[model samples]
Target: MESPDHILVVDDDAEIRTLLRDYLERSGLRVSAAADGRQMRAVLSRTAVDLVVLDVMLPGEDGLALCRDLRARGAAHLPVLMLTARGEETDRILGLEMGADDYLSKPFSPRELLARIKAVLRRTRALPPGREPASAAATLAFGAWRLDTVGRHLLDAAGTVVALTGAEYRLLRVLLEHPQRILSRDHLLHLTQGRDADPFDRSIDLLVSRLRRRLRDDVREPRYIKTVRNEGYVLSTAVAPQVTLRSTAPTDEPA
Candidate 1:
């Protein structure tokens, strides 16, 4: 039988750590907790963790720094879900830009955190054993960018590869799927994050900004993904399918 998905909870708060460990373990997940980055590294060195539930506020080597280090240490493939007490948009954006797959504010329900963790893992295709894997979508090409749905890779016009986080990739894929159609933040959040937007959650906008920066799309005059101003955002470029699937129907583009 396949082992359960393991999670590492990194937080300096003993209460929160204990609460998470107990809650997550009771939910049939294997969880390990670390009070700080040093302990986190120690746990990571000896264990195969599927995901990290990181608290943004720590005594030393804050969660942002640790998350940045994790990405730098070639652990970008590991999904990270950030927990923060700040609840500020800037802090959330910083966490996402630092490679966190999702963020949850403080005083949150344990149920919601569990849901967020599952969503992040699902989006990253890191489900536990006995679960069916999601099928890859078709490869999409627009302007100078090529998205390989099979490999979940994004290649630039110059043939160089662009690294995108799970959220960013999902947002870009949804935008590509509905070219020229303005997708509101609520719709984008539902489609990509598999969750509804909280009144305080600005994760969708932050993710869009990060994707824009990665694609080198000018915010003032984006060439591909355009902001529709008070409506939503749209992918303004035509996409060509690089992979052929007989089951798919051709899309008609308006002249």
Candidate 2:
């Protein structure tokens, strides 16, 4: 719709990749393609891409392994929308865990695929700019391991970094911002999503449920975030601000 934006299509199936390439071009977006991880890396080395349309099942390494590798090395930051044949809920959850911004099952319409791509890109572009790089703080320690918000990464009692989706991070940030203060669903929805809180939607509840599971906090008796019944939710612990990352060259490196 807007001018042509470059998108990389990575899938072992050449037919699907070709079809998407042409369709995306017709939609006013330029598209690149890769058959596997190696080609994906080669293309990445040569061309700049805005977003990636990736398949979970690849030739050699699976998509999740690649996602973790990219994060560890800080190689790429492009938002990814996964395409998968698995229609199970576990597959959907795993896709999110693999750093996919969004997902779609097989037998999806190309128009629907386009819509999902747009949604993922829009959501990713909307996140606030972080003060530091993602790897700056792997784990944030606030009040015990009960409250941790190190940008996209949270931490547990064992000090292991916890993976959080974009929405979960945003929601957690909102609660941590006003710890101990009661914020209604409307306020939270506006603060975190910049959208009106739906009276009937359970998006917030679902995110909280996922977060609690990862944090190892029981929903019945929470220690970090507590439910206020009709009002909303509040962080039960205190928050300490993140410090700026420092260069370690003894402050004598040449400018």
Candidate 3:
């Protein structure tokens, strides 16, 4: 049997913590709750957390600070879903800029939160829910970058590994798949994130910015991925698949 995804919820409100723990657990996810950053660190040290559902307004060391700390502390791979108060667009944007995978405003429905959690997990794990798996290992070579689909790693022209976060990898892969096509935020969100994007959500754009930095593409005069005026972003490079080779024993032994 597949293990349940473990989630760590950090919120100062006792009522909110209890509410989320009960609700998430009922949704078939293993949940751990922490009331503050100190408690959050303690829980993280002991458990293997798959995702963190963090409340933006904590008593001390708010969610944004904690999220940044997490990334700086080598927890970049861990997915974070921020819960901010409704109408706090600035908070939501800051959370995304701080390396959060997704965000939801407070007073949210349990069902919506559950869906967001699943979507974040799908993207973080690079699993296509309800989709067919690739027949073989696939690699995409574009410009000076080589993406190993099976290994989920990127290599530059010199063959050095280029690290990518979950969101960055997903966004880059989606762009690579649809080269030269203008992908709107909605389409990109659904394709790479496995969820519908809210109109106010700018996480996709923030993710693209991060990816661009990693690729060292100039934001003003981007060479690889370009921004379409009043439209969306597009990968202008040509992408080609690299063939995978299998090794076999020699048919005849050498004399």
Candidate 4:
């Protein structure tokens, strides 16, 4: 039988850690609690955690720094769900920019946290229905970049491997799969995040900006991902699926 998903809860507050541990365990998930970044690292070093529930406020090496460190250390595919006491939009954006998969403000319902955890896990572990598996094609080439689908990262023109967060990889893969087509924010959100967007939701836009940075595309004049004024965004280039060895390098070709 498969083991239950293991979650590592990192928060300075002992009460909150205990609360989440008990709550999550009761919800059919294996739970581990950490008091701060040090403990968080310790748990990760020795455990095979499926997801990390990290709090923005901590004693030392705050959650944002920790999350960024995780990404830098090649934990790009590991899912992270952040928790913050502040409900400000800046905090949310910062969390996403730091490579967090999702964020929840404090005083949140345990049920809601559980739901978000499941969503992040699902998004990380499997692609939605009707989507081709990443391994189907070794790479999807567009412009000066090629997505190493098997590695779940991007390769630049010089063959530099650039890591991608789980969310960024999913968003970019969706765009690559449907290159030259305009995808609405709601559609992209549902396809990549497994949820519909609300009127005030700007996560998809933020994700696009992050992806643009990864692709080194200029915001003022992006050649790859172009923004549609009122509709959505589109990859204004042709995508080629490369499954076998090729003699020549890929070149940019407009779709």
Weakest lDDT window of 10 consecutive positions for candidate 4: 246-255
Tens digits of per-residue lDDT for model 3, 21-119: 899999899999999999999999988999999999998899999998988776767899999999999998889888888888889888888999998
TM-scores, each model vs. reference: 0.84, 0.63, 0.84, 0.90
Q: Identify the candidate with maximal TM-score.
A: 4
- Maximum-lDDT candidate: 4
Q: Residue-wise lDDT of candidate 4 within 1-255, one digit each (tens)?
A: 878999999988898888888999998999999988889889988978899999888887989999999988878888999998755777778889999988888889999999999999988878532134433546789988898775678899999988888899999999999999999999999999888887877899999999999888999999999999999999999999888343343435210
- What lDDT would candidate 3 get against the real structure? 0.83
What CA root-mean-square deviation does each model show from the true structure?
7.1, 6.4, 6.4, 5.8
In terms of TM-score, how similar is model 2 to the real structure?
A: 0.63
Q: Per-residue CA lDDT of candidate 2, range 146-170, in tens?
A: 3333346666657676656666677
What local distance difference test score does each model get? 0.81, 0.69, 0.83, 0.87
lDDT of 4: 0.87
Q: Residues 78-146, candidate 1, lDDT per residue (tens digit)?
A: 889998775466778889889888888888999999998898888777322112223325668999999
Rank candidates, lDDT, best first: 4, 3, 1, 2
Ranked by lDDT, the better of candidates 3 and 4 is 4
| Position 107, candidate 4: lDDT | 86
Q: What is the C-alpha local distance difference test score of candidate 2?
A: 0.69
Worst lDDT 10-window in candidate 3: 246-255
After TM-score superposition, the amount by which residue 80's alpha carbon in candidate 1 deviates from its true location, in angstroms, is: 1.4
Ten contiguous residues with the weakest lDDT in model 2:
246-255
Clashing pairs in 1: none
TM-score of 4: 0.90
